[model samples]
Target chain A: MPHLDILKAAASSNQWMAIYPELLLGSLALVLLALEIILPKKQHAVIPSVAIIGQIGVLIWLAFNFHTVFLKPEHAYTFSGLLHHSEVGQFMRVFFLLASILVCVLGTIALAKQKMPRIEFFHIVLVVSAAMMLLAQSNNFILLFVALETVTVGFYILVSYFRTNPLSLEAGLKYLIMGALSSGLLLFGIVLLYGVAGNPTLPGSSANPMDFTALHTFLLANPNNFLASIGIVLVLSGVAFKIGAVPFQIWIPDVYQGAPTPVTAFLAVASKAAGFSLLLILTQNVFTPYEKLTTPVLAIMAAATILFGNLAALTQHNVKRLIGLSGVSHAGYLLIGVVAAGSQPLAIGAIYFYLFAYLLASFAVFGVMTHVAGGDDADQDLAHYSDLAKTHPFLGAVLAIGLGSLAGIPPLAGFMGKLLIFVAAFKAGLHVLLVVAIVGVVISIYYYFGWIKAAFFETWRAPLLEGETDLRPMCTPVGIMAGVALAMLALATVVLGCYQGAFGDWLLALKF
Target chain B: MADLIFYIFAAFTAGSALAVVLTKNTVAAALALLLCLVGVAGIFVLLDAFLLAALMVFVYAGAVVALFLFIVMLLDVQGGVRKPFKKATIVSSVFAFILLLLGLASFAHKGVQTTGDLGAAAPVGATLKSYGEQLFTTYLLPVQIVGFLLLIAMLGVIVLSKKFEGLEDIK
Candidate 1:
């Protein structure tokens, strides 16, 4: 009866408030699309500004609504349980908003150096960001599938934004094929789960099986169902692909290297964040009953992902490919947090903290890379970065600190993040995984420092031609904005590393 | 009579699906896919899901097939070349056969009940109306989200396919 009333009430316009952020962002995307059509080409520069401002406005709106949503976690289900409002969802929304703003800024800087359809880029990114936010809040399979596809479709274009680059086009095609395949797998999994859950006889029945709570109940009731196990495993594999885990890690390096640097940064941070959020939701809510079946599979994937990602990265000469491979390892570490969920009560918080730290450090490094590459793919070779410290000391320092943090140097955010993950793994009695993670970290330092060495100590190798000057980094406003973004991220990395307690306490307060 | 119609549609669906895979020319394959979609739509009609049947025809057979043909023509890829099957093809066929067997086995050994409550059985007209009502009410969020997904896809197409000044130079 209570659920029926919720369904009835959800049909009213009042339910609109539950999804105001998505609505606002969607409208903003449409508005940008209209502007793109109406505005003269010369005024295309204004589109990114509009996207950034609109995102900030949504962030402010989310902040104002946060307390109201946070206070009544019990009443968080809205749109008849399509969306869930929780502290974690709120945190993810903020994370996605901040990431979107940074991406928009980064994309603007990158677009300044290359001529393409700039307005559409901002709109598509905004749409994808909005979709990701919805994904974090999704409480049902239908929303999950749609949101995931929205993000994937948007990324297919963003990755190949530079169609002129054969590499970019190839990456886009590879991503499209793989992404479509994963989507098929995910849908098939959902169908299998749906069939097992049985079709709902009554509208909005507590037995409406796609609903998370209902699905949880069904799974608990029928834990030993073979079809359910297959369904869950299929779903997990699809998500693992999205997160760029091993065996599914084939596309990461190529896509990351081939995409425009800013888009690469977006994929690295926001796209991965969305995938991890969905994984968090699935593992925490849906698959909790089947932990025994899933845990071992996840552990093996984690170990393989860490080993392969780190070992392969050691030989990569392209900066984007290196970061992409290392990103796979980070996914492995994050999987550790996921595996520890049942055993460690604070594991979710640890995952959040780790993602937060990773976001800052990775974004800082990507921002510097975007600045140095200046929208050109040819400049991405590691050798091109040699002796950067001699000419651009500040840029060199940023790269050094960013890579150092990624390598888990002490007194940086990444170290604290790794420490939190390791502690959680230990508390969960995952000694083997903890050891493998440590080994992965040690292996990672070699290549991370290789980039650092190139940036700092290595002398410029190619002899200078007569009167040929090195290509000076662009000093445009977009370039300055990228620098500022990197500096702020670097500062946040250092501050978070130093004062871990504050963030830790805040995250711990977030009820899963 | 209904059983006869179901068998006919099923046969056509299977045949067209195989043709879709076996056809060497892209355009012919697309046409085979269209027939397969129509056959599936006919099967939906037999299942009493008239709305779904109609959508299968309109969306998949009509819109999607047309789009595929458009792309095939636009790319001008008219059976340019065909390569002989290689060792990789044999390996892939073996894997595909294994997967097909596994799927068949899983479906055959259904210990758990596959068909659950599918709502009160009603007349086809009422069922279609109720389906529309539920779509507009119960599943409104997903509908809106799908709308956004389509919009994003449209934007992606424009950005990737549209030729602009200086694009050729970069290529």
Candidate 2:
């Protein structure tokens, strides 16, 4: 060993200690995989619980101890600058772990719908969850892109989990083409950004932070540069594609319509939340100057996204398509926070709060969809939901709460999430955007209620003169999901509105 | 001087990529893409990262593209006969051309970092040694991860394609 290098090793115990959460989760993933194969098939279900425990423990560990890591952002010791060990990273790490557990339970419950195997599904969920966790907290662009791909490749498999279902295949194709396009755009933009960074006459501070802190400083130091602006747009486009934002959201409806209900819920909620987390970290760290320059572009996209999501949703009779469009509209709302960025912390905070609300609500709503329409997860028509409330009051009630929350109705968590976002937007001097956001919120109520009415008001009518069909049978497991839904809605009532600080701290601690 | 060479090779890569996309025949497209891959390698070489360029060719062209061609031929997805340019294609191509021009114009003004580290360019052996060291010391976990992924994929494919004793073969 070089004599001076020995001193470098002796100097950095804290650096090794910084990323203990990621290390623990990673080791736990391997242990879970091994345990899955070793454990008896009957009790293999316990594996996910074990994984969740490991994940939650990391969060608890971080919440108690990671503030010091956050304070010492410069103390990362990794493959050059590949992994950033920070409190913000530790915080976002929790999302990946928690979301994975949610997905595993939801997916395992949903597997009963199609009678698919659980072990592989659970294994893949954990793997995909690990990838999402890795991607969200990534500081380097190369690592970020790779992590996104890792999550998505697993997603492709999950989308097509129902092999015999033609609709599932269709959804898979749409996701693939659109995902590839977004990735191509992302790669091209990365190459260009590399070019811009390559030509510096002076050596950079701290060996190219490839992470957000360095990237943000670089972009901000030279504000007028078009490459930085264009790069930011390209990166945002990649994320928008993931979250199903407009212009990039053309693939969403088809995927939602075709995929298993649990998969759609996963896509719309947790996966989309991961995209929000990525955007949050990136905007906060990498494109701090993007506020001054790219505000107009974001404003236009946000306005269009809200308008398009609403107008398209109103015409859709398919419950899946409606929910899909609903997800897109919410993305438009989240973009308001993205637009506000570092200039308004509360706006970004609102985006994070809204993600939690949206995820829980979507899961509950899709849970009801799985319950009532026990077909091939393809029958998402309002007609399918016509007689739901009559037979299954609990499911209907859960559906109502989900739809109401999604529509931003007061006293529900979604409404509080939106109100906080509105306040944030106002702080950012986005009056026009705020008014449009409110209008978007109001218009959403009409569409969301339209479905609720169908769920609640199910009077039998004489068969249509032209054609007739039999409604599918509702399944028993779906009833179980409805129970999960009721629990989530009840939790949202007080958990989000009253104790806003609980989620607010978790979301805001995301800033690097 | 190196930048000029890099630009030349990069244009070659860009042109080759365009040719790959434009080709009507699948075989021709694959061939054009091969050229594009090689040109990208050359661009890497010109960037003073000779080892990376060599690795690009060795891994990308030698393994990935060869696998791609094999799968392309296996699938028999005909590129179909050439037709007159559709309005959408024209709009897309025009948009692409405009983007290219804008990119070039902006790139000319950008500050690029160039290194005069030509002598440091390692051969296949030395390059392998360094790459191995880097992967092991720095990216050991991610590297190990890629290996596990390969193992899983192999097991999955075996499961998918293998036959059973009692089940009637569908084919």
Candidate 3:
């Protein structure tokens, strides 16, 4: 009877409390829709400003009330989700919300500056951010499917926001087709899991729900269960496709190159961050019983993705495509933290911290790339960056900082992220992975600097750059984002390497 | 008597499912899928899930397939069938054969356990009352939230498909 009362109270309050993030974003989505409709076409800049402010408000709201409500044990924790919150959930939620807010700011100016339909772009982004918020909290496969598809539908539109651009349209179509296929695979996995655990007539335990906790217990009890193994494998495969895990990573570079630059940045950073966050939740919580297969599978995939992403990027001259591949390689390293799955405070903290680092570095790099090769950004080729140091020194320096950090050069956020991950991997006794990471970091140095060298070292016979080209400040948001990224990078270089103990412990204490 | 009813529906279910894959015209394939779904509903009835069986027929077969047909009409699927089966017939048959082998293996290994007594434990309506009670009490949050999300998804589809509130709230 008390359980009944507790359940009822939970159900009542969960409407406002458990799903606070989604509810907040839901309100934001509604406001955006209303504003998009009511606002005059010429004054569309107001729409993005409204959304940016609103999204930031949600982020602050999430941060301020973080551990008090969301971290509280009672109301927020309900349902059989693929993930639930601990300190890891809070960390991911805070960072993901922050990234999404940054993206909203970036998207506002980016689409407007490109002379695209600015209002609809903001609408889709807000709705998708809401879905992403739910995705980070999902502990059940059903919620996973629903949340992932919500985000995909938004991406399909956002990718083709430049409807007049054929490449954008093609990227949209490819994304839709391949995205639907991956969703199908994920659905199949969820349904098979349902088949395994949901049948009330399954004899021994008639208490099968899609709840992650019970499901984990059942799988652990029957560790050799073939059905459980198959379900977990398929789910992981679905997640791998989400994070651009190799063998399922074929669609990424095309999708990244073909979409609008801002959309690509979102896809590369926040979108991928959401994917990793979900992966952490699913593997660590739902499939904990089947860790044996999950670990080896992730290790093999991490190795393959890192190797393939790096190798493929070496040949790419297109700046966007190169960064796209770089995102894939970074996903591989994040998998090390995943493979090092234990109840360790430091390991999980490292993963979340690395995500924060990667997000800023990526945003800064791609933010600069919008004007990388041209003032008009005509060619977007590597050769265009030759003598960039002489022409657009600030842009070149910002790019170098972003790329250098990404390549894990010491004194940047990427290096700290990588170092933390390596330490975590070593602590987890992943000797081979630590070695591979070392070698991979070295390989990364060459490719990343190769671009840097072209930007600064090589001299071109071209005449003096035009004022419009050189003085645009890499478009409007580039300087601001560079500031954000550099500040973050500085933290990675100086603070994280030195003073991360308390912050890391606090991050580890987060509950989703 | 229930066993006979189950087997009859199961055969129809299997046959229609096969036809859905084998049919030539796209529309005909969709119709075959509808038939397959109906047969599945019949099997659900045999299992004594009165509400669920109704849902299988009304929601899945009626709504989902209808939506599929709506989309199929917009996209051309049957253009240039030119020698569709001649080259691939042998390969597809081999593939089908391998699938058959696997199907046989799965059923043989598992050895079907009769769910006959499961139905005897409770009648549909009586058990459903308890389920409803639990759903409203214990499983209430997921039920409500999924319902809300679905509402949002439906609203989204409407907003995208019917462009209202664009020009002074047009559409």
Q: Please tell me which predicted candidate would have the highest TM-score against the true structure.
A: 1
For candidate 3, give the docking quality class from DockQ. Answer: incorrect
Query: Sorted by lDDT, highest first, which candidate order results?
Result: 1, 3, 2
| Tens digits of lDDT, candidate 3, A1-512 | 77677566745534446567767766776787787678766665577678777777877887787675545565446543333655566666677666666666556445544534455666667667767766777766656676777788778877766655677777888998988888877777776676666455553332444677677766666676666576778778888887898889999888887777778888887788888888877776667777777888999998888888888888888877888888888998998888885544476767887887787677767756665523232226676677777777776777787888799877776788888788878878888877777777788788899889988996545465666343323434345644564455444545554466777667645432
Top model number, lDDT: 1
lDDT of each residue in B14-85, candidate 1, tens digit only: 999999988889999999999999999999888877788898899999999999999998998867576778
After superposition, which runs of candidate 3 have C-alpha atoms over 4 Å from their true positions? Answer: A1-10, A13-15, A74-83, A113-115, A199-208, A343-345, A371-379, A459-501, A508-512, B1-24, B67-78, B82-116, B120-171
Candidate 2 share of real interface contacts? 0.06
DockQ (model 3, Cα):
0.21
Q: Candidate 1, which CAPRI tier?
A: acceptable
Candidate 1 clashing pairs, residues 3+ apart or interchain? none
The order by descending DockQ is 1, 2, 3
lDDT of 2 by residue, A180-209 (tens): 899988877776566565434423422343
Winner of 1 and 2 under DockQ: 1
* Fnat per predicted structure, each in turn: 0.57, 0.06, 0.09
| Candidate 3, residue A334: how far the Cα is off, in Å | 1.4
lDDT per residue as tens, model 2, B1-171 = 877887898899999899988888887788888889999988776655678888888998789889888988999888777778999999999999999998777667663435555355343223666566555554544554454345334433433334434222211
